[model samples]
Target chain A: MAFRTDHHLTGSVNIVTALPAEARPLVGHFELRSSRTDPFSVYTNGDSSVRLIVSGVGKSAAGRAVKHLAGLFDSTGSNAWLNVGIAGHESLPLGTMVAAHKISDEKTGRSWFPPMVLDFPCETATLLTVEEETDDYPDNALVEMEAVGFYATASDFSTHELIHCLKVVSDNRREKKLDGKSVSELITAQLAAVESVVQSILQLSAELGKRRVVPRQLKDFLEQWKFTVTQSHQLEKLLRRWEVIFPKADPFEAASPESRNGRDVVQLLSRQLAEASVEAEQL
Target chain B: MIEAIYIEEAVRQHRRTAEILTRFPKARLIPCERYGEVFNPRSQDFKIQKRRPALILAEKFDNFVLPTPDGFGIGGTENYYFSHMLNCLYDCRYCFLQGMFRSAHYLLFVNYESFMDAIDSTLDKSTTDKTVTFFSGYDCDSLALETVTGFAEAFLPFFRERPRALHELRTKSVNIQALLKTEPLDNCVTAFSFTPAEISEKVEHGVPPVKRRIEAMKQLAERGWPLGLRLDPLIYHGRFESNYRRLVNDLFAAVPAEAFHSVSLGAMRFPKAMFDPMVKLYPDELLLAGPLHPSNGMVTYRREVEEEMTQFCRSLLGDYLPAEKFFHCAPWS
Candidate 1:
């Protein structure tokens, strides 16, 4: 498959789990890296792009995976981030596929999840990202490591195109055991549905890619700050905010500078404006 | 910084409406007998109102400062939270905003002065020696909307007047330009909510990256604003120790432990009722993947798992700060 900046890869259907043994067969050939710096391979579906990165388990590793995957896509292009993997379930039956509606960190109670992974046709609920594997989840039903980091880091790089976190229930509190080989069998059984889910995600990304607009609110702030378009992109590129929304606007266009205008307007309104005014005269 | 004006209509006949308006004088008042009429309900999704989210363009507010959630402070008792606006621009899958509001439209209370006046009263009521903490970035990110509202710059002087009152501006936003332009305040703590790099990429929707957030933290710390690290909603994953350790290493590497005012950590837990609706929304997320057992009616990871992670994290934090400074939400001894 050819790589097109405008073409978006959906349904990366990332398997972010410790149950790599479960995901190995269902997924195409896999790659591993010590960290994001290692070169990675991407699967192309002719029209879209897909990269099955084994982001080592945990919020930080997941966050790094998100950052690295986001880096693979042109900042200004359309990209969707996913954390496809297996998880533990409490209420539902074994082998139930759960979508993490929300991803909360057990360590920092701060939430970095999207609203429920809204699946109208099926049941969806919040997925708590725990740092440990245990039956003690207070409110969340499914458990995984990388979802929050993926959402947090990727959302920074892209705009709204990220999607997909299909988690097959591997362990139940009732059972209190994990059989890696058995879990792999369950995922393999659902391979076709997983493929379909991945396809739908890519299709959605392609649709979202066309005519992406940087919110006027963000644009206005960039302008007021006197950030030249290139300068804005430079800051955004470093910030990675421009990664998903870039490669579209001329990077030198007026929107970037205009965004800083909002900041400038506030500066002028504050008494702090006086300091800047004096500084301006010195310049 | 917003050039806001407030308009009063017959709706002022309603006390809440009238009270909301008295607060924002600078806001351009656009009077319509009805705000956008699209707020009715749809059968499929209960979260979105048929009407757009209600927008209250007010002239002022009764108070700009509000008390923080109970059991929220890491080490302090005098806690407070305030919002210059309501609603976030980015739509994440797990946001409580979906469950909390009938509408999605943002409500920007344009009144800056009334809120300031309330702050004065609150400050007067509290003893000067005890730190009266005012928290911003609750209903909205403190700095995310600052470009439009300039709330932080507006209240900086107010908090400055009462140095005894500590101001904490918490946010997941990277809008540090506002914080950068001004001199750092000893009384103010600029706190950023960060997840590991990987979790942020997949789930945070539209927040800034972890590195950029660290950069912003570095910038603020360099400027002398007391920095705070919020390792919130610590998502679990395999090889989790190494992942979080890197996050800690990355953060400390960027900013020194001495520069931090404090670091707070907690796990994913929500009120019982909020769970079902949130679940209905995002059925595909892995963060939701696990055996969900409840404790004391609030939903969260099972007790043993929660305690283990909390203990693990507390020790990790001890590597940087004294054990006395670290705070946990569960309150278990």
Candidate 2:
């Protein structure tokens, strides 16, 4: 599918969960409503910027759901992807929250480290993704079924800094299994922490979005002149430079009546900027 | 402060790694087979990682020492640079490290003996009888993390044994407690880099103020340690001359020229590859928005501006120091 050109979904969040019980707390906490339910269940809030998808159980399912959600929006925008679910640990008490610093695939033995760039709300631990649901948790690590798939797929759509996984300890050595009700209760118990994580990631995504915002005048210039694919890129770069060099001034003031095309405009701005001197106050 | 520490499996049992780990007992420890697994990835953002960079302990397999780029020496016939660490603690906007590496996590090689062995071998194979200057802080600041790395403590004694070999520790840090406690060595020169106060306050984030660094230099000079001045990457502004003159006068007032070993000046320049990423990172940065253009695969100011800045600083510096102590560094030349 073709991506959306309008940046209405910038600084959005896409969440993936392997079970409906794990996703119920997040959907309700974020006030998300059902948006799609044919192939997979998806929920989104009012503006459709915050989304949650239930991927039913297993690695392949979670990977497919992430790919599907990513295809529904403009992937080029600064969006965050998070995998929130329950995992089994050896010694941690039930309802304890943790973020994954290292995720390893038990089948392939390949590992990925998610760079933590923010002051995370919860503690961090190594997470091992296994093929089957087992009570065998590795020493000092959490064992789950879908984090490796969720992370490995989401990385292709966003930067590692914006991709993360937060897990709640639902099963441990003392209690090796839990029902759907218990899983939902465990996720609901930590709803405030999950909300804080979402707020932090959203703030970071917004900061990144601000850095990549295009100059407002570019749209007007593009509508006025016809530019080829390569010339459009050149025009955008020149416009950005003009904005930096002459922030308070307008590029239209420098364009002469003799200018005929986008190339002429690009040359005019380049010449003017080259002649300009950088002042101390500008910094 | 470091929030996490990534330990390479090969160096998990290294003595230096154990010593460093004891310093940050509260940091989360994560183990990996190689440091490259965490450092060399493509999707990581340097700006965000710089906010809270982790510490990676790994072993260097090879390339412990390499020759410095041409025109990068002070007075030695043979100049070599070695990096015991990969990145700096401070986030200077003009730093090449921002463009060279995709990740900002500090990768420190724990195998100090291998570096000593390699330096010893390089000294044995030296073809010239003239002195060989070994430079630290090319890739990382030599003294910024002294308390945590103990880099100066470990390597100073080795250089002391070889009197003919000269060592230069380049830094912008005021962390001179280690240097103050240890006995002074004639072969070691503690070099400090500086810019004008106006520019330093804007671009050099997390760096110690200019006055504090000068105070550190005064303390070192009083203890009989030779010092070097690096007034490099000269930034241009409307009041460039007046600001630089004030800086030079302030520096001379603190430390006399008799304690100086050498001084060098360089203009602001970067390879096109590096400059492109920096501009992308900070598109609105006034320094990058200046009158810079591509010349011979490098981005630098116009020829007249570069020459004018260089000549003005050179003439101003010549009034205090001798001609032999001045060196002009033009890496792209």
Task: Say which candidate scores most in DockQ.
Answer: 2
Task: Give per-residue CA lDDT, model 2, range A1-283, as digits (tens).
Answer: 4234443325778899998998888899999999888688999888776889999788899899999988887776377889999999999999999999999999998899999786778899999999998978799999999998999898888778988999999989998447888999999999999888888888767666766778778888888777788878867777787888888887876664656888888777766765568755666
Best by lDDT: 2
Per-residue lDDT for B1-333 in model 1, tens only?
Answer: 222222234445544446544555543333332222212212113223211223444443345676655677756667776676766755554455565554454556656666777766787888646777777766667887665566787778777777877887878888878778777788888887776777677667678888988988887888788977777776555545776788888988898787788777877666656664564444333444233434576656666656676677778878988866665322112
Instruction: Report the lDDT of model 1 for residue B273.
Output: 68
Alpha-carbon TM-score of each model against the true structure = 0.48, 0.96
Model 1 chain A weakest lDDT span, ten residues long: A274-283
Q: lDDT per residue, candidate 2, B15-123, as tens digits?
A: 9999999999999999999999899977777888899999999999899999988877878888888999999999998898888888899999999899999889989
Which pairs of residues collide in candidate 2? none
> Candidate 1: global Cα-lDDT?
0.57
CAPRI-style quality class for the chain A–B interface of candidate 1: incorrect
lDDT of 2 at A129: 94
Query: In model 2, what lDDT does residue A97 have?
Result: 94
Q: What is the TM-score of chain A alone in each candidate?
A: 0.61, 0.94
At residue B56, candidate 1 shows an lDDT of 45
Q: Where does candidate 1 chain B have its weakest 10-residue lDDT segment?
A: B35-44
